[model samples]
Target: MVKVEFAAALQRHVPCAPQSVAPGTLRAVLEAALAAAPGLAHYVFDDQGAVRKHVAVFVNQQQVRDRVRLDRPLADGDSVFVVQALSGG
Candidate 1:
């Protein structure tokens, strides 16, 4: 199973906790997580099913480059971290 975790900063806005799920592509795993926490979908994804601009998804410490398509595959035991991207220099 893949472990999905929410960053501390994002947890302030939503109730998503660390969870384990079946391995699949980034989109598939994310959709499954959203099903478990219906309300969290809006904060992570946009109306067109794309990851929100402010959201960052990392798989096993590597940033997901395909934000629009989210086709990156996840293997068993992988860790996915979801965080709100920070801006402003």
Candidate 2:
């Protein structure tokens, strides 16, 4: 199972910040997640399906820098966290 978490803003679409999902690549996992929660795509990604500039993802606690790398493989029991990044000066 892949555990997914979202920031509070994302919770409006998925009440469960932390959700378990079937195993798949990061792309597949995110696609399935968007299908499950239609509203989330707009909130997390841009029209071209790239992760929003303000968004960040972590797989097994390691930050992912390449949004195009979504097709990267994911192992079972891995935790996937999607959250909006905070910025301030």
Question: Per-candidate TM vs. native?
Answer: 0.91, 0.84
TM-score of 2: 0.84
**Model 2, span 21-63: residue lDDT tens:** 7889897887776676676778878888888888998888998
lDDT of each: 0.84, 0.79
lDDT of 2: 0.79
- Model 2 spans > 4 angstroms off: 12-17
Error of 1 at 39 (Å): 0.5
Q: Candidate 1's residue-wise lDDT over 10-67, tens digit each?
A: 6786777778889999889888876777788888888998888888898889888677
Per-candidate RMSD, Å:
1.2, 1.8
After superposition, the stretches of candidate 1 with alpha carbons farther than 4 Å from their true spots are none
